[model samples]
Target: MGSVDKNPVPYCIVALMVVMMALSYGIQSADAQVITYRIHSDIFTELQDRYPEHAEDYWSSVKKAIRDGINAWIEVNPDLVVTPSHDERHNLLIEWIDSERVWGVEYHDRSLGYRIGIDFDSPEPDEYGASLLNPDIIKYVVAHEMGHVLGMGHSSDENHLMHGVENPKPKNIFDSKGYVVPHLSITDYRNIGGTQLDVSFHLQGYNVHDVAVVDINGTQYLVASTGNEGLHVLDMSNPDQPGLMDMDDSPSTDVWPLEGQPHIVQMYSDGFRVWSLSDPANIILLETVSHNSILDATLIYVDDTPLLVMVSKGLIQQYDLSDPHDARKSGAHHDNFNLLGVEDIHGVVRDSGSTYVLVDATFDGIQPYLIQPDKNPARVWHSFDQVEYYDHIQRIIEIDGSTYRITSTHDQIELYSVKPKIEPSDEDPETELIGHLLGYTVLGVDILEVGDSVYAVVATGPDGILGIHVGDKGAGKWTVG
Candidate 1:
């Protein structure tokens, strides 16, 4: 037996065969790209030769570990199709190695593609008798190695599984939810909102800037844009257990998934892009519209016409998006109206089932507009509440037949009942604040409906993701999960 260090060491590699059960999971969809893995023969032979007494247990544990690792990735991205492969271009190769040091090694071989080598020899348990070969520990190691296969480099965070060190203690890896938090990221289950709902999950270490949800056919998905790292598409078909379905590793700041269509308009610093998600596993870039002043945008359907509404320096512009590959300017609303210094636009959302649009213009507050047939929109109202500097108006969703706007500013989120002044009125339509929650900076937000309850999932920069139950205690109220 050799002592293991915090880093991978050079060792002689001996391929050993192993008999294992490799479960294959498939995604039934059109022209979907699938990631395949092959189990090398070295595993069973190495385990049987090294520890014949526990060879069966070792083989079973190793098999389960691989399955568990793949499953974890599927949970985060549901669009992934990882199945057993017996071909030339296997994405991953799993094998057993008789190594003196290191529990596992993930290396790329020209002929083998990506390969993972697990140690066949188990190290002596610590004083507490916690062996390195424990089933849960092995699963965690395999999951960490899988992260490398998925193109994630070693994380500097010591609490992360990709930190390059394998701590054999189970207590440090698993949380009360029975979830392998270390393998994913440190997730805080404590209540962070007023609703008392548990924070479902967190993609720690990633600076998530914005999120949007869309329904494809009968399935629902959420798109999370993390700026330069790219965008993540998560399947929300099972609201309680959202699975990551796909990811586009392109720089993105905001994403708006088109309604009743498998397309999304993603906005970056200087421009925006259109993507087709017909094949969630293989997201295709359809078009890019570059504008130096373009800050943020959203897709809205006026009557039956699909329009791309964008905000810039001091103007709100509309483009015809009937043809997703090409965008042509149709209408423009200059800032000469009621808008005040509209320099920074964080987000835009159309009031549900209405012709009104709400813009989250930081410092300027919420700006409401009425869509017209001639392409030019009319500014209905502009008001600022001097409580704090507003960042973004997350969404304007309909709950219990009432339209409510969710807005975030600094370190707090507020829900307000929005009534657009469609008809000429003496008193402005009720834009009254219902309830608010004070917390960390909430950069982006989206909603999920489970049965009769509505959950608001938010991206809190470094705080990761948190879930809130809308109207949990009663109507017009929120509770943190």
Candidate 2:
């Protein structure tokens, strides 16, 4: 339903097709302009059929909570959200079904709308099944189930409401007593789930400037910027208490890694500083690109050719590092943005053969620019609408096929699964809302995958650095970790 003039539509704009079992498995792209849900008569009839002995007021309370849950999300997002007529079936449906196996099942119908089924037969015997009438917890349950409809996966962080399983242990935000109720975590706001654990470490008692994680041999090290104190390399084998490895003696503005190649790190300060990690314990500066005050940079590989793309104030420059030592300029684009004085830009990520260029807080919130290196190498797709309420964009990371937008507004990060745009085309690829997480004072982010797990390393401004495990959200395994 959403389209762009010169701007390309984002994958999350239109709802993708979902089967009834999509929730049990997974679904994508439910970001319709207006998503509505109605309490199906089947749910009322199910209550009327089996629980005829219960008071009518009890069922009414449960129904209200479900509606309240949907309304709560509407208030949080920028979209026009509403509930349809009492008798009308809408984009999303909430119903009660006879299923003793599970308490709730969230899925999408053939129309590509979502439906959440609250099992009337089972009230969660292990976790206060009878407390379904408690609207507060019920509201949380609705929100959790609704998150999947919005295209969110389970959160690895147990503190988030999207935790897949029940936690008997008491946590700061989760209430396992009775029905499991968890606080709704702040996310991207296109709307998505998945809890994130914030693991932090000190950078020589300094407020960390920026951080990058690189694996050398079998050891992983954190190359972090310490203001003017130069670079501090920390041993991240134990991510909790990172031990300092070495320092660059000269500080850098930011850091990035060359894709596929290990031990090779890029630091940007007055210009680009390349380093070699032949020794995991020590890092050596290899070459320097004299371009001054580079805002952001990303590394891309086409065939075996390595391309280093950097964005400055007014122009985006590309360099071909066919020879790592003898670097050469390959291509450059001066007129990338139509908006004037656009300077809050932060990050660039590449996924599925496409390079996504991102800009933050430019009238519209953070949006993705899908750039493909085709015959012309200039094929780019502009990202979709913005949440008018949020702040500027901070960082953006694209992994697997998912795009994460870290925004300045409320320190929120939004997750969206972008349809594979292997090549550039006028027909905009659709994206679905994966979920969101709120990180306070988030300055930078780096997402890395090693085997079955994924990790997100965030650079918080004053609070220091945070090491987060993004959880196995994509794996359909939703047990509370």
Candidate 3:
């Protein structure tokens, strides 16, 4: 007995319209989609236990509650349509249970739902019933499950309905007190409208762990390796779902897309592979240069003069990719020279028009490596130890003239501000640590930034993928879904 509420407040309507306009104008690739859900009752005892005489009335009320929650979320995000399904065209399935045997099950169709199985015939009061029967809990469950149907995974943030557990602390949705929580927070609305403008994506598999983005011209590509599947390329003419372009059997760890050229230079475990994508479907392989001890190539940068900087395991190698079709290794240098002591490098970004490189270091420690590419040592970068120890550095972006780095460690996300340092004597300056932003314990992150805001696609354990908004320069944070 699932129902849906059609009418919503005017403020919610305005917010949804704004969100849709932003998505349509900002992100030109994919269309904003919606989802519908349906709840079914399995056994008669299940309803009878809860409402002895007025089972039908109670069922309708429960359905209405679920509908209200769904409508609330939709009012905030018009792009996310939540409606009730009368037939089989539903995105999610809900079932009321009467026993523990059917506690959790993953259906074959990849469609997931929740089961409220209870022992109605038992003489004793059901402990699980007490928690599940709560109106707020019931509504929360509907919202949480609908989150999955809407493509939101799970999240470690306790405040999120997608947080796996049936009931999370701070009982109320709005605040610590038991108040009626709105579907989307202010920060959430802003993020959905902001981050979609930037076209950036992260790729991970095998030893290939890295992030990359297609620049303004739709021709240039930039990538940074995080010690796994170096930097790889995908054809993005179809921006909604880009496909891998470089099919080289060798493991390419990092890549940097060259401006004014139809080719992207990538670093593989064995060497460097330059690819020409004028014909994106069938990529033309240009050249491959071999390296002796280069275990992984983390990042690559090419200047106006066409000098290439490739950051690899314990070293940063520079190359000459000016010839697009014919790339050659020119220079190579090691950072923290000793291979045994060097930490894994995650992100590397060269400040626009500057010779220095902003490197995000993780696993070894949360420190900023400011590298002066002109110096002989190239290790002249200052190391800041302000950020706590984290295992992985996921993404880094330059927003509002400030550099922000995101790291994944132990089950949490840490954000840091990078400020450039200027010394009177030296031409190259050092980057100072400004502050830390919001943190959350989540499985993985797919983050992007557009204009002044940041959005993260977080992987919640059983909850699924959730889109979260971490405000400008750590100003504020909230869950959008």
Candidate 4:
């Protein structure tokens, strides 16, 4: 038997044994930061062995106990996010064992990671016969064991959740939904990391791929494209309290709103479509263009004419949208810049009566092109210094006669100074790195200017939408708020 003092978050009633294996639980990454746990099959088998007829009832009760146990810690500190994994490999494992000594045990093995065992068949000598099988008792025991997983130990107060023994009638730590209501001490607060304003508000959906915000008649509307849920239009007049105004049943993978117009370009797996958001309450599809392998598309304006740029495979094709009902292909650029896996079209920039298109070539880096009404897009510059990184969306702006581009890439939001070279000049256009804000899976970025401050509202995959302080006017400094 090994000592229990050395294991991480150990609260074992029996002798602890050390095993040789790597732990997979509690592994935090740039994309995901939640602790994952899996339920062992033996837990259900144990219930089936004891109560053959009411096995389903016992099975559901046990699973709820485990979930409520994890929720207890989250109620105390929301930063300690926990979710169940159906996969065999996970951070923590819950199981049932045949034992009469302890109600539950929280222990760790080097190879198997952390695990909690509940002795459901144990019989107490008092009025509580086989009380360990009681749902309320099981809930209390699970919560107590889960506390150990959060680095908590036995509390001297018998009324506390971390108390060693399970009470016959435990404290009302459960709600009407059978979820744990946490009761934490000052020590618990000091021991755990509390939640931050990382996530402002989240609308539950399935595989949301892209989003675009536009204002129609002084009312802001958000158009989101999802993998399985199709399109959703939400009223964003209230930033914190957005309401789902309407939805379209056509599946889309990306979206871009046409500025100053009540139209939106939605990209599908095989083609692109244009939808009219004139009435946010009723989103109507206007036109559809079917091709194949369309990765991303954006609407840009050249010489006051609306043009749609679509990147398919490795080809950058242009379609003139002069007639809102009819989209005509004008020109296409199939160069050898090796842009087969173009991840995104970072919109366009209008400077000195010239329009420039920016693209995120996953393999070749950021590529800039000078586009004209009836001519092929000419490559102005290729950014190789910031190469080999998967860059996403970008927002361009001109501040004090200087052009700046803010782009989201991999796990960070980057800022660059874009200076287009004048014609007849031998020098190429210069793009210099300005600054970056470290983030996680930044999928979309939108800049909002309020008074003297500019903020980057970024949609980070699982981390939610983060509003970062880009910088104040003339401050020339960026910070994460």
Q: What lDDT does the true structure give each of the candidates?
A: 0.60, 0.53, 0.44, 0.59
Q: How many clashes does the backbone of model 4 have?
A: 3
Report the C-alpha lDDT of model 3 over 391-458, residue by residue, as the tens digit: 33455556556665655555334455555656554444334332222212344444534444455544
- Scored by lDDT, the top model is 1
Give the per-residue lDDT of model 1 (tens digit) for 430-459. Answer: 687765555447877887665555667788
Per-residue lDDT over 1-481 for candidate 2, one digit per residue giving the tens place of the 0 to 100 score: 1111221111121111110112432344543556656777776666666567664765787778777666656655545466665655566767664444443454554663566666533322111212333444455567666656766555444445444533222334433222222235222221112433333333335666677777777566777776677777777766656787778767665666665555454555666767876675677767778887576666656555676666666566667766656677777666445423445444555444555556552654444544433322252554434312222233445654555544433455444545667677524455664544443455656654454556666666655665555544457545577
- Residue 411 lDDT (model 1): 59
lDDT of 2: 0.53
For TM-score, the strongest prediction is 4
lDDT by residue (tens digit), candidate 4, 353-412: 577777878787767777887888777864434322223477766654677777765545
* Runs off by more than 4 Å, candidate 2: 1-204, 302-304, 334-410, 413-439, 447-454, 472-481
After TM-score superposition, the amount by which residue 99's alpha carbon in candidate 4 deviates from its true location, in angstroms, is 36
Whole-model lDDT, model 1: 0.60
Angstrom error of the Cα, residue 392, model 4: value is 6.2
RMSD of 4: 17.9
Structural similarity to truth (TM-score) of each candidate: 0.47, 0.45, 0.38, 0.49
Looking at model 2, report the run of 10 residues with the lowest lDDT sum.
Answer: 11-20
